[model samples]
Target: MALTGPNGPVMTREEVDRTLTRLGAERDAVEASLLALQDHPGRRLLEGAELSGRTRERWSEAEPGLGLLWSMFDTYSEALAAARAVRSRRARPGQSELYEMTELLRGRGVTVSAGQLPQGGLHITGSTRMSEQVSLTELVERMNTWYGRIIEVASAADAVWTALPARIDLLSAELGRVRALARSVGVHPGEHPAGDALEEMAKELAALRGEVVADPLAFWVPRPGAGTGAPGGSGSAPGTVDTGRYDRAARTVDGLRVQLEDLLRLRDDADERLEGIGETLARADATLAEARRARGEVLAKIASTEVPAVPGPASAMRERLAQADQLRRHGQWHRLGPLLDTLEGAAQRELQRARESLTSVTAPLAIRAELRGRLDAYKAMAARLGVSEDPELIERYDQARRMLWSAPCDLRAAEYAVMRYQQTLRPTAGPGRNSV
Candidate 1:
């Protein structure tokens, strides 16, 4: 039965008993939640951290809010205990006990002083009352609101701190390795672009790490659909840690490491590369020398032939190769890399030019030899046919032989004489053409 009373309808004994059981469970849940918040790692970090920026400002308010949660919890606990005590006085509460139980469970039975609340009353309630009276239900709602706000701040700051600083430290360590490799290859700051960039990146990561440690919230981006009132959200966590700058720095370090590694490889291969270039230049010089000698022979043996002038050896490229080797000895691998490439290309071209010159300068001698072979073959064919003593054939053969054997040979005149001799032999040597 329900009785109309000042507080509200008085619950029946059964109703009161059921209500007590439910409120007791709520009380335990509230207690557990409060204790968990108290022992939260994020809360502890917030307490000890030298926070700055928005984090410091939010924590300033959240710190007081945390205290308020405990105080209001105390008030809620007391009201629940009082209601339980009134019911426990009798297994079946009388009318008066029922009235009090109704008020504690459903009516505004908990009173909170203004001093216990935040500056402008509870921000959730939107009230500035000097003091407030609320029911147990209202008290729990208020605490949930406070917990959401305070945890949001703590968890967001913690997330940023957890994600970035440690990664930056790892990257910094990798940066050190890259720097050492650069030094080994003689790629120092102010001498190589990668080295200077590495130095700048080191400074940036240091500053970034410091900023993350001091004010992690600055790097936090709230997740979409997340609310300020809850620690958990619809899709994901309340927010995410921003890693844009950190990722960029990581990519830069990787690129620098690649460049430095290439330089190291170049340093290891410098000797082999220098040796190969030296051989190429030497071959070019030998070819040019042979061409010069052949020019003298061609001028002596072949009359009125123009031999192309052979170029000098690749002196400039040889000098550059020497410079590159000296740089390698001094551990200046960066400078040697490009110089070796240029020198190698020039050396190949020099060798090709010298080979072409040798071919050109000896062309006349080759033609004279070819003519002499043809003339001797035809004369041999004539003798085999028993025409060696033929008056006309002997005269033509002697003319061709004199031109072929004489130094400063007239190649044009000798070629004509050989052709005339071959024509003279063709009619008589029809059966012996295959032998010739």
Candidate 2:
């Protein structure tokens, strides 16, 4: 409540009261902080864990520093209590009481026992086994330093465990579903590349999860430097988990899922295509039989002509179709896909060839029919022109008619006689009545 020169103040009722109140508040806050640090989950885990690597080595040093921190706090508490007792004996403190309170609050009045501070990387200065005295202010500062380091190690290990292991478990569950689907679609290990890859990925994920559970600290990534004070005043900076391993595993599983889906689609398409191919091949066989019958008719009814022989069913294509069916039954869709494509095309081509052959086989009969129709048309023209009894015209028409009507007839001779009949009748009909 009153301002004084540095180290010039003396006894005053108000100043001493305010100082005690301030010291009491500081003590309560310090005690609460110490309890919180002691009870922290990360701290408890670190204490019980069988840590290794950098974490294990650093924690070994911080462990003794932690003991020293508590020991120093105890001494500070005792010194504060003793100073309060001295002041409480009177309503207003004497000069000696005031001087003691100032010394306790601002001077070196607390002692820490020897062998409490480890020598690896603490900021304390004293002989290895010598006791040292410090002011309450300095003691609090030293405790904060130790608390920060210990929390730094503990928080990093905790953070890594929190981030990675559970995600790995979820991915592993999804991986199981993918494996089942793959097997259903005939994508078994050693039979398909995708299946083999899936198996390898599953093993890697299992090992990664085990390593993380055994030593989470190995995956920890600390901040820039030691003792840089933790973010948000939690006495330790937050750290990152090594997610590269987990991410790679997730990506592999995703790829396998895509491959399995594609295989399933191919299976459906192959089944549909194989059914269609069977129908096409059957149609081709029927058409070839029809073509063979037409060839016999053409040979009997028309002479001086040759018909091309009809093709038989495509043996190679049917053989491939059989192989594809075998693959489908054995759940070997990968081999069946390409073979089905080839069979479908061959079947279609075979059907087309049969139709073309039928057309060729009946060509001679078609010619004979055309010649008969022409000969009859010319006779009607001759009658219309009053030359139906013309001697030469009548003889030519009769000859062409006999050639077209008789079996094993020569189509070439019939066509020639029909043309000659038209020429002779054209003159008898005169210019206006010429044959069309």
Candidate 3:
């Protein structure tokens, strides 16, 4: 039954008991939520971290809000305890006890100090210099607001710490292995371009990891479309850490690793190819020496033709080959590989030149031998025609033979004389023997 008293329909005992029971449950829930917030890992991390930038400024304001939260919770707890104590004194609360319970539940029984409701940009409306009184329900609403703000800050920071540092560590470990492999293959700073790049990446990664550890919030990536203002500003959403820099570093290191592998393969190819080129160069020198000796012999035995001098060995190419060997010994494969290619091409060209020279130097000797063979063939043809005893033919044959067989013979003059003898014999030998 509802009683109509001066204060508008006072609640009956049954309604009073129900209201108290509900309030008690609400109080228990609020207290549990507060305790959980206190023990939250994010909250602990925020408390211990060396924060900076907007996070530092905002935490300074939020810190006071945290104190107010506990203070308000304590007041709410005491008020609930008093109400419960009063109700438990009797199986049914007396009129005075009921009046006290109503006031505790709905009236302004919770008091907060000035600036403690919400300060430092929190926007809680109260006199800054005077204390304020609020109902238990209003106080709980205020506590919820404070709790939400503080939790946002803590959780955002903790999320960045959890995600970025470990990923950086794993990437750094992979880079270390790449550096070791690079060293094994003679890819080092100042010696190879890719090795130098890898060294730079290592330094960047080291600095990035250190910065992340010291101030994770600095690396936090706010949610897209979130507010551009400070952390506690309106419409701001929480976000995770940014791993873009680390990802780029990882890709760069991987690219360098591939380049180093190619260089290592080139090193092996160059070693084999350089050895072959050295053999080719040695053969070319020998051929050139042989050509020079043959030139000397042709000048003495075959006259009236100037043989071109055989070219000397290519000393410049030999010098380059020696430089390549030095580079290979010092593990400068990046330089050695290209140098070897150039030397191999030069060596092959030199060998070809030497062979052509040898052929050129022996040309005159070949001509003199051809003349002697022509003279002998005409003599044989004359004997077959039964003109071997002809005095004119014998005189011509002996003249050509003396010129062909003698040293320093003028091959041009001897060739002319042999052609005259052949002309003289061709008509006598008849048209059927034109070739002989």
Q: Which tens-of-lDDT digit does each residue in 1-436 have in candidate 2? A: 5434234555365766776787678777767766766776667777887766666776775666666667767777898888788778887776667776666666676777655443455444444657767777666666666766777766776787778888999999999999998988888889888888988998999989877765777787765554535212555546577798899889989988987887788787877888899999899889899989989998888777878988777888878888889999988876776677788788899999988888888888878888888888888878888899989888888888888899988988888989999888877777767454
Show how many residue pairs clash in every candidate, following the order shown: 1, 0, 0
Model 2 lDDT at residue 356: 88
* Candidate 2: stretches off by over 4 Å: 1-20, 114-129, 223-232, 265-270, 279-315, 334-436
For all predicted structures, in order, the TM-scores are: 0.80, 0.66, 0.61
Off by over 4 Å in 3: 1-23, 94-99, 123-127, 187-192, 224-238, 267-270, 273-322, 337-436
Candidate 1 clashing pairs? 303-409
2 or 3, greater by TM-score:
2
Q: Write the residue-wise lDDT of candidate 1 on 1-436 in tens digits.
A: 4478766677888887788898788777777767767777678888998888888877876777778888888898899889888888987767788888888888886898654544333453445566888888778777766777677777787788778888999999999999999988898889889889989999999999988987878898988876655312221238778899999999999999998898889998999999999999999999999999999899888888777888887777867887998998999988889898888898899999999999999999889999989998888788778878888999999999999999979999999999999888777556736434
Q: What is the C-alpha lDDT of each candidate?
A: 0.83, 0.77, 0.77
Cα lDDT for residue 431, model 1? 72
Q: Say which candidate scores most in TM-score.
A: 1
